[model samples]
Target: MQDTGSTVPRRQLGRYLLDWRTRAGLTLVTAAELLDISHSSLHRLEHGQTGRIKIGQVEAACELYGVPEELAAAFTGLARQSNGKSWWHEFGDLIPRDFDVYVGLESAAVGIATFQPELIPGLFQTGDYVRALNRAAFPNASEELQDAWVQLKLRRQHRVTRKHRPASVSAVIGEAALRRINGSPKVMAVQLRKLADMSTLPNVELRVLPFRAGFPTGLWVGPCVILDFGITPAGSPVEPPVVFIEGSTVGNLYLEKPHDVERYHRTYDRIRQRSLDAVSSRNLLRQVAKEYLA
Candidate 1:
């Protein structure tokens, strides 16, 4: 059995399997028995600690869990791709189409360091802003569909806002992102004010990279997020860090290599260094909101 170099996809797949199993109301031992696997083996697979994921076993488990056809296919696809060092979830691909692998990763992450060059990070986006973007992105979609998308974004924000163990967020937003008008001026004003308010949260550290900080990295950097899982009591990472790069036209990229993660961390550090401090950023956000209101 070959070891999977990166655990990102495996972890994501495990999360999905676990969710399905729980929803099916099956105990771990019962589910393992139904899938014809040992309890320890099933436990390992559910924890993303298994080696050489067998596609057949994944399919059997999905079948045993009564997962839908599309979702079952998606899980199998993830199992097939779990051996790679890095995973690119193409927008057109079956796995990404049926399931959002990134959301699972984000939910499991303990801390996130993100740099956004174009738009407000999803965690900080207001409902109106999200609705506006969704309407624009899916112009032919129904209002109900748009509302669903908006609600999804809002739910994702709970990661940073929940009362218990909210994830730590460090975000550096480009000035351009703040100035860009997605919805009406009123919407922008509300959105900016929300950003300012959210920045006040103890777990969130928000900064803005002004226009004056021209090309801190000597090049244009696209939106990227670094997700760090918490460490164990022994001081070792619970799971490896992943760098998620959002591709506007193609698909999302997950980099799990040490070098790739380190490079993005360095870039994020440089960008953060050039950004306004938390107080200054909050001030700028309010000032911008006032300008929008005016």
Candidate 2:
């Protein structure tokens, strides 16, 4: 079976199906029995692991779960898109095992809030910066493979750059990230300048958490991204917000519970409060870039 490459529609479809099934008070086994499928099959379908979801099955499940007509139609549409390929699928092997899921969510999000303490965020990285990071991470990889990874990074940036409905970005970077040299002084200079340039976009807001901020939360805060899907016409969120915590020694975490999401939001709010404003951040970036050149 061909991998579906972590398509967003499939994940959204699975989440909706799972929520409706639970609301209907049906256990997985019971739901599977009612839907005439094996328990494991239903499990995969609800978790977005099944490849090529059938529209008929989705429609049947929606009816069985007593899903509203409008939502049922939306569910069916998601099923239709479940088999479609995302651009990131081409570089699947080059990315981390679970990172594709993050890419999918990022693609579908209407707004993104990112906090990076140690390095520049991927969406704002320059091509040279990306190549340098990839080379460091995969020193033995071929030049062609590194180039492919750079392309993938550039493609991800389209979320912030596209002319139509560009995703709104609010990013807070620790002073360490600005000072840390990824490839070389020249590379860092260029990267910092690029960051300044990107910050000028109407959809992008950049802030700097200077060293003087002194850990506003009084604890170590790692890198995290909060993704917000836009709401529907009825004023209901299309999907709940998710907090993605990356760079754990174990593995990345995707926090979806309401309380967890709220906690991250509060944490981000506090961090943003301490960070320099957008104008100050832009000035800081240029100053540091000039320092690197000197």
Count of clashes in candidate 2? 0
Distance from true location, Cα of 30 in model 2, Å:
29
Write candidate 1's Cα lDDT for 1-294 as tens digits.
555667787888998999999999999999988888899998889899987799899999888889999889889888877865557888345474647788889999999999998899999999999998988888999989888888898999999999899999999999998999998999999999999999999999999999999999999999999999999999999999999998766778899888999999999999999999999999999999999988
**Clashing residue pairs found in predicted model 1:** none
Q: Estimate, for each residue in 1-294, the C-alpha lDDT of model 2 and write its tens digit.
A: 676743455776787788899999999999999999999988888877788888888989999999987667667766765675542222323223432456667877999999999999999999999999889888999999899899988999998998999999999999999999989999999999999999999999999999999998989899999999999999997777878876435555566667988999999999999999999999999999999999
Give the whole-model CA lDDT for all candidates, comma-separated: 0.91, 0.84
Q: Which segments of model 2 are wrong by more than 4 Å?
A: 1-99
Question: After superposition on all CA atoms, what RMSD does each candidate show versus the true structure?
Answer: 1.6, 11.3
TM-score of 2: 0.71
Q: Which ten residues in a row have the lowest lDDT in candidate 1?
A: 91-100
